[model samples]
Target: MSQIPKIPRRIVTGIKNGRSVITDDAIATNVSEHFPGLIISDIWATSQMPADLSTEIIVENTAFPVVPANGSYFRYVSIPPDKDLGIKPLEAGQVHPLMHKTATLDYIIILSGEIYMILDEEETLLKAGDIVIQRGTNHAWSNRSDTHCIQLAVLLAAN
Candidate 1:
C-alpha cells in the first residue's frame, strides 16, 4: 500500500496540471485506497463525517434539522437546490458568501466532489472528509470541479 501524503493547509488554486494535486485531496486519497474516482459515498457517515459536533447545514435550501448525536459531536446536510451556485470562472482566491442559519456555528464538510470554500479574502479547498469550522463567518461553497459538490455541515447552535 502507498503511504498517505501530508499537505500544508493554505490558500492555493489552479494547480490542476500538477500530479501533486491528487495527493493534496484528502477525499481523493481515500478514494484511491480501494475505489476508483470519486465514488466514495461509503465514508460519509456520522462517525466518518468531518467538522465539529456543533454544526448545522442548509444546502440548496434543504434544511437539516440540528441533531445532537454524541457527547460533543454532530453534523447536518443541506442538499442541493437551496445552495445558490455562484458566478462562473471562480477566481483562485475570491470569497463567495453563503447563507447560514441565523445564530449558529456551522462546520462545513464535503460529501463528494471538490468545493472551494471562501471566507472573507481566504479560500480553502475541501474534498470529501475535509472539514472546516465556520464560526459565525460569512462563506460560500463553489464547485470548480466538473462534478456536483455534495456537502455536509455540522452547525453549533447559538444561544
Candidate 2:
C-alpha cells in the first residue's frame, strides 16, 4: 500500500505581549484515513463565532465531531481515484455510497488534481484552483482521474 502524503504545514498567528506573532508553525497531526486511500487532516477548529483570540490556541489531536455545532472546521482531504476504491460512476437514480449531507456551509478549494462534485441529480468536474460553495446538501466527491485529488475545505456551522 502507498503512504498518504502529509498535509501542508500550518502557521497560526496570534497576539503575544500585545503584538501579533507567529504562535504555532507545524504540520497538523490530527489526520485520519477513513478509507483505503482516502485521507483527511483536521487542521484547525473554533468552538464559536468571533473566535476567541485572547488565549494561546492549541489544536488537540482528539477525535472531533465531523460538524461542530455552532462553530467552524478547517481540514484538508486527499481523495483517491474511484477506480482504486472499486467505485463506479453514478448512474441515473443512483446514489454514491459516500453521498451524505451536513448542516454546515462548506467552502472547498481544489488544491491539486481534479475531482467530480456529485450532487443528488447532477455532477460537475472541478480542477485545481476551482472553488465550490457547498451549502448544506447531499453530495459526494468522486475522483475519476488516475491521480489523487487534494482539497482544502472550511466548513461553517449553518442552520
Candidate 3:
C-alpha cells in the first residue's frame, strides 16, 4: 500500500481592508473514510440559492454535508496503488461497490500516476493529464499501479 503524501495546505485569499489578504489556510473538510487508500479534500462549495451579498466574501462555504442543487463543489482526491477497497459488486443491474448515481456533472482530471475508471463491466485506464466527463453516472476509481495517484474533480449540480 502506498503511503499518503504530505499534501500542501490549502490557502484562501480575499479582500481585507480594501486589499488582498490570506483569509484561510488549512486542509480540506468533509473527508470520507469509506474507501481505503482514498483521500478526498473538499475544497469549496456553494448553496443552491444565491445569498444576498452586501460585501465581498473570501470563502463563502466549505461544508459538503450534501450536494446542493444549482451549485457546485471542487474536490481533490488521492488514490494509492493496490488498494484493498473490499468493495463488492452490486447484484441488481451493473454496479460497483463504489458506484453511486449523482445528480451532477463531474469533471475529473488526473494529475499524477495512473488509475482505472471502473464502470459496469467496463474499465478505462487513465493517466496524467487525462480528463473524464462523468455525466452523473455510476462509476468508481481504482489504482492498479505501484504508485500513488492524484486527481482533481469539479462537480456541478444539474437539474
What TM-score, over all chains together, does every model reach?
A: 0.43, 0.87, 0.76
lDDT of 3 by residue, 1-159 (tens): 567764547787777789888887886544654356666667776655473223232333332224667777777777776445554433457555455567788898999999889886688999999999988777777677777789888888876
Which regions in candidate 2 have their CA more than 4 angstroms from the true location?
1-3, 55-65
lDDT of 2 by residue, 62-95 (tens): 3223655777888788888988778887677878
Ranking of all predicted structures according to lDDT, beginning with the best and ending with the worst: 2, 3, 1
Q: Model 3: C-alpha RMSD to truth?
A: 4.4
> For each candidate, how many residue pairs have backbone atoms clashing (under 3 Å)?
15, 0, 0
Q: Residue 143 of model 1: what lDDT?
A: 53
Clashes, model 1: 15
Leading candidate by TM-score: 2
Please report how far candidate 1 places residue 108 from its true position, in Å.
2.7
Q: Candidate 2: minimum summed lDDT over ten consecutive residues — where?
A: 56-65
